[model samples]
Target: MHDTIFDQLERDGFAVVEEFLRDAECEELVAAGLELTRHLPDAPPTVFSTTEPEQQQLKDKYFMESNDKISYFYEKDALDADGKLQLDPSISLNKVGHALHLLHPIFRCYTYSERVKALCRELRLLEPAVVQSMYIYKNPGIGGEVVPHQDISYLYTEPIPPIGFWIALQDATIQNGCLWIARGSHKSAVHRRMLRSPEDRNKCIYDRPAPVYPESSFTPVPVSKGTCILIHGNVVHRSAPNRSAASRPAYTFHVVERKGNNYSEDNWLQEGENAPFLNIYTTSQMQ
Candidate 1:
């Protein structure tokens, strides 16, 4: 199983670990997520949210609908729109993220699970420890494409070596925006480009040759709720617009080796390097 996943990742830059969590585990996670969602405030309106005529109109504009429960343990100026990087006062009371960060079995499984450790041994990344995570929820009626991009572009780590585990909380399918990877694309040299301004979000860089793969190039990673997809940090990946009748929820956690480790810096993209604190939201009444 390890070899299969390893080979797939080497060839495709990503692999799906089917049934990584049992059915009961999926149910448990969903329950925990539901409980958490009840207490979280609705997302602050984005540009599209206020301009649209209705909730469905907003969904129509972005081609997607998602309710996010963000845990912001790490804060950096990188995400700051203006010069000031302030803790969002709206989320100051959120402390439950610590529970998800340190104790969740899924988080541990992605970071230090035996299978993952063995894979790390093969990849030779055992020095620095794993250090971060974030969860995502994509509800039905959400439609948007995650444009083609490399994960390293956003994180900016030196060695550019991190792994993202996308665990499904509900069954994922092609109709529901399941992930698609460009085979053998992880070998490309890293590039750091400016974040697209709101007006230029659809732009694509064309400086380098596009990565190559077989004619049967794309692989759709579909799995039952509770399975996971392990992906390389540098892989070229994206997803289709969700057009399914059901909601497709998933949690993605990014893990990296702990700080102060010697690694490749030749192709490093200069960017933020701080460990973010966990951001949590709860709807529970204080006891």
Candidate 2:
């Protein structure tokens, strides 16, 4: 705690906070994350790709309607050639996403825990609203690579950009695909935008070229369990594929300023009237 998280975030576009949560807390979250799929309905398997592939575009209703539900997506390689899972659900699942914070009890409690409130206050996030939550299970041997990109590309806002809180429930290492970020890349413009197609509501389109970084530009950040990585909205970051025998579990979410920012209507995630994004300042869970 020598340098403040805010200072490091401003200087590097990302900050590492070690021991933010204890081992017991991390274990609780990991076990809770494992049960997320039980809340999902019986739908056809949907693959959550870290890389946007034009051939297997995930722009259908299943991906679009997950903003308010606890949804399960499978790892691409975990499925057989016929699109059926080749492994158990626990090992084949890629992530549970979008609404865990607002809908799930355990996730909601942690999302608004005292430590999170203190962190938000310290970062000076006035009128902050939760955008999305993800519990990523980088399953052993089949974990995919997340291509380098800026967060603003998906969660766009005018005037104010979003910030992400990525917490590791398991130890993150080079072998387990720890995050690699381009230092100070937030100073650059957003590399691309994920916009809803004008004609087709079921389609998602990219505006600019996808991010491509040099090998030497990124620095791998390996953190122990219960640590958090605060990422700037415009920072270029990505993770390699986990080919090791271990699993990497992480809980991440984004917060946006609601006061001075206009959330883009064409963004991938749109809040409904009945289930609007929760403001941390007024959420009862904060207490």
Candidate 3:
């Protein structure tokens, strides 16, 4: 079965593993998403933009600290003219990101589950480490558009780049901003990187120009609840704005092969020397 998964990934650049999570597992994650709001940390309102994340999100202190902390970001439409939240925090929240899989118990359990361990072994990742995780709330009617981009451009690794496990907590449909991935596009090299500037580590630097992809190169992948999509690091993908009344919430994390891989120092997400990325094989080494 794992061999089949690898085959599909090799052919398609992305593979959908239906029923990757049980109904109960999906419910728990969704419940945890709601529970997160209770522990809010007086976050100053900031809008999240995938296209210009460096300009919009990097400027905020909360975003810079989110690497090891579960932080909140609001949707642009969730705010009013004066930059105040016009809707409920639950309705306005764009995402709680960068470290839930490491810091939150519920998230940590799933991230280190036997099922995930099996995947690590299949990839021959002797020491698999997860550097980042996110719980994206693609809320109804005004959910934002995520511009086409590659995962390795951000959480990059040398020789063997990380892969993404994007699990859906709710049904993701075309009407609700389901992901649109370019078929077999992983064969292309990553032309740009969203890295930290040398002069200002807090700022971002794009090593090359963003490549333009034609619409015919992509396909919409609508999946039921509890499904998981395995995305290659260089796969070009994006999601349209959610125009329906329902939400398309998903939990995603990237796993880097720690055996013989070099994680770029200039990557926007950098953990201090003492606090390193969590090794999935070494549960006790949680950071």
Index of the highest-lDDT prediction: 2
Backbone clashes, candidate 3: 0
Rank by lDDT (best first)? 2, 3, 1
What's model 3's overall lDDT?
A: 0.84
Q: Quote each prediction's TM-score.
A: 0.60, 0.95, 0.94
Answer with 1 or 3, whichever has the higher TM-score.
Answer: 3
> So what's the TM-score on candidate 3?
0.94
Tens digits of per-residue lDDT for model 1, 121-213: 555554534444444444444434455667765444565466777788889888887788876778886644333234433332223433334
Q: What is the C-alpha lDDT of each candidate?
A: 0.51, 0.86, 0.84
Cand. 2 TM to true fold = 0.95
Tens digit of lDDT per residue, candidate 2, span 195-260? 999988777888866656898999999999999999999899999999999899999999998887
User: Which regions in candidate 1 have their CA more than 4 angstroms from the true location?
Assistant: 1-4, 46-123, 194-217, 259-287
Model 2, 257: alpha-carbon shift in Å?
0.7
Displacement of residue 127 (Cα, Å) in model 2 is 0.5
